[model samples]
Target: MPCPERHVIILGSTGSIGTQTIDIIERLNQRGYAFSVVGLAAGKNVERLAEQIKRYHPYAVCIGKETEGEILRQRFPKVRVFTGEKGLRELARLDEVDLIVNALVGAIGLPPTLDGLSLGRTVALANKESLVVGGELVTKFLSEYGGAILPIDSEHNAIFQCLRAGRLSEVRRVILTASGGPFLRVHKEELDRVRPEEALCHPNWAMGSRVTIDSATMVNKGFEVIEAHFLFHLPYERISIIIHPDSVIHSFVEYHDGSLLAELASPDMRIPIQYALTYPKRVETGLPRLDLEKISRMEFETLDHEHFPAFATVLKAAKQGGTSPAVINAADEVLVERFLEGGIPFTGIASGLQTILSRWESAEANLKEISSDAGNQDEVILSTLLAADRWARKAARYLSF
Candidate 1:
């Protein structure tokens, strides 16, 4: 039997992933794919959001800020309006949406994700931070709600596709490939001198400013470590990142008997986005098809911990699991934003996280002891964790250049 038309709710629809998703939807619409747009949102790209609405005609749109929402409402008075972060949540929770694609970046993506999953919508997640900060919450949500959390990130999507080749019991390990960003060639000692422009110039992919900086700092890769841990339910030690200059091989899975499986394709977001969209069925995409002949070389190097300390930071946080990864993520996001604003050097991203980790460790907080909230999970979930985040940001700001 054919699946019914799927209704999509897209958050951050004007951002890189969101815009590419809309592009995919346009192609799918032309090809008779059975899907309708229900909701779409972004952070102040009102003009582009309006263009998306004119094309997809979603029932609602969110701009992630009140002023922008007000302006959009005035521009299109007939469309149902949603304003600010809460409005984003309301849009995510809408009943008509069959699937929600979360494209918002950073920790800000968390609440809408929770709202979407709580409403039992199938979620295609491009926002890896959601899993990084709240992996346990995400797992519990899936267990309780039975909503599928499909990955839209290329690496995780590759792992998702590779896992299909065999059973989980046979799986041994997963290797997430990274292009290593713009600084892969920069000497270890030269990192202290890296400027914002150099860090933002990603060699392989075009992304938002924050993620671009995260990629250069490898904090993005660190977040992906936690993401893979939750998405595949693998141990942190078993989940590894390889610095592959060519991102052709997205990710790989190894079986217990030593058989290896890999997912390879051109570095394209539409492929993974479409995979999550029309899951269990592949579709024709206008993306450049992978050409093996021209790409005659594939190389992999171990992630240089000596150069990128963020890699070790993630491993430490993962080992000290519970709210520690969330804290690390919250701090890194804040610090990365500062670095991008020219308040700090590129190396400050890791230094800042390290400072916060030491500060919290010395403070009256024990992440493992506080996991289940022997006394206040709600407070941990909201206040303590938030305070930890704020405290980390303040420390980073003060210590940073």
Candidate 2:
């Protein structure tokens, strides 16, 4: 019997996760899985986007700028092209798309996620910001529209697989493992002097600049904790993070009966990416297998809050709920950029987050009386979060360390 084709639209198509998704799709197709790239979207990477379009020949595509979209249209006249943030949402809501692979970075990825779920499309999500910033809204959409989100992140993907071992009620707690990045052994007093080049050198995984820096500060791990809370419907207390320097065991699920289930694989994004695409049906990936014999040893350590102050700050905001997480995420995005540009010291990221979050909390307290009586609840929530996001970005830019 011939297999039905699964049509996929990949946002952030030129990014690390996005490119690996394309690789997995092509590999799947070769293995008798009918996976087709129906659409591709990228931000400001016209050269790479053009190459992907030429190779895969998606029916429609989207780019960050109108000028780039025009260039693409001239090159491939028959292919439909959409532009900007609105274009991303349009691509997500396309009727023919079976899977919406949101590999886009930062808060910009949240809206398309909501749009895709609004029509009940299954989202293969690599955008942690979507859950970190708008988790409540995302959960509401899932409940109301019956959409699904399959995590593409390594930690969450491992948890998703380990969760199959037992019922949700029977689970004791979920553990998210962190690689601790390049600063694991650095003394707290010296973090302020560490250069951006030092933080970017992640030992385990190849990722984007922002994410790599986040890993160094352990802010990425904090984001994962928030993501896990939403993905597993677990309380903040039930989700714990352990510093596993080896990056061997992605995550662990503990059962009430004192048994632990873990998903182990090599540190490859392709493993999780492939799992998200062919969920409930495993297939050969043609990638190198995890050789535990060669690895020999794995070590785990407790997360030192003093060493990674950003992680602690992020979690505090997450606990505060409402627009707090959005503010912190937006602020961190700006701060990371500033640090990479040599404008701010490495320690400035955490201290800046603390300052901005305190200011946001103070300002939010003043606006407590304001009520959203006009629009839909979701609209009100989305607007509120976006407003906080904007405020944080502006605040972070002018903030002096």
Q: Quick one: best lDDT, which candidate?
A: 2
lDDT string for model 1 (349-379, tens) is 8888887777767753554344445354533
- Estimate the overall C-alpha local distance difference test score of candidate 2: 0.93
Which regions in candidate 1 have their CA more than 4 angstroms from the true location? 1-3, 364-384
Task: Give lDDT: candidate 1, residue 116.
Answer: 77
Cα RMSD for candidates in order: 2.6, 1.4
Among all candidates shown, the one with the greatest TM-score: 2
* Cα lDDT, model 1, residue 238: 89
Give the poorly placed runs of model 2, Cα more than 4 Å off.
Answer: 365-374
> How many clashing residue pairs, candidate 2?
0
For candidate 1, the per-residue lDDT at 292 reads: 98
